[model samples]
Target: MKMIGLVAIVASLINVSIPFQSRAETVLSARDLFDACTRADMDWISFCNGFIQASNDHAVRLGMACTPAGTTRTHLVEIFEYSAARLLVSQSELGDAAGLEVASAIIGAAFPCN
Candidate 1:
């Protein structure tokens, strides 16, 4: 009887935790955000592997020069240029102007093109 009670308790705990995992979602495409921004702000290479995967997927999607090198600083500069151009055009669309400026500064730190 004790064993059965313990088993039931464990089962209930598992059931309760299952939904929590499913309800959580990735907030942003780490690579897209990094490419559009910077590594320093993102803890430097924390998202490298994931960013590479996303970039490869994007490369396949857009047929652009996005190689497996997307996670590297060199590749990131190219991505930054593209992202900056897009962001410049869509400045009015950004809801948080200050946040965008900060992000731009962080990205610039990695590649001081400006």
Candidate 2:
């Protein structure tokens, strides 16, 4: 499916769509993000990019709560991608909250403020 907007969908899925909405992005449900990210309708490149963007946004936001010092944004995105991959493997059937939790955990574990 059209996965270009998966980020906004994900944000809404976790009840945090203010940033996207403020940017004029449409808020979609978790089902939509899941479909767009998992379905084959979208090309691999687009899907990969979407995931990268999604992971980037998630990591940056989570980093705000912690001191991710000495960690570059690029590195954070990469770790987030790995976390996303792990989520896809095991949490695919779970709800959107599950995904968000895992993402936060990944960032927190990798770059804890304490």
CA lDDT of every candidate: 0.38, 0.47
Report the Cα lDDT for candidate 1: 0.38
User: Total clashing residue pairs per candidate?
Assistant: 0, 0
RMSD of each: 19.3, 9.4
* TM-scores for every predicted model: 0.31, 0.40
Model 1 misplaced stretches (Cα beyond 4 Å): 1-25, 29-37, 61-73, 85-89, 92-114
Determine which window of 10 residues in candidate 2 has minimal summed lDDT: 1-10
**Tens-place lDDT digits, model 1, residues 4-113:** 33223323333444343353353332234544345455544545444444544443454433244335655654544454444434442321222223233323333332
Pairs clashing within candidate 2: none
- Reference-based TM-score, model 1: 0.31
How many clashing pairs in candidate 1? 0
By TM-score, who's the top model here? 2
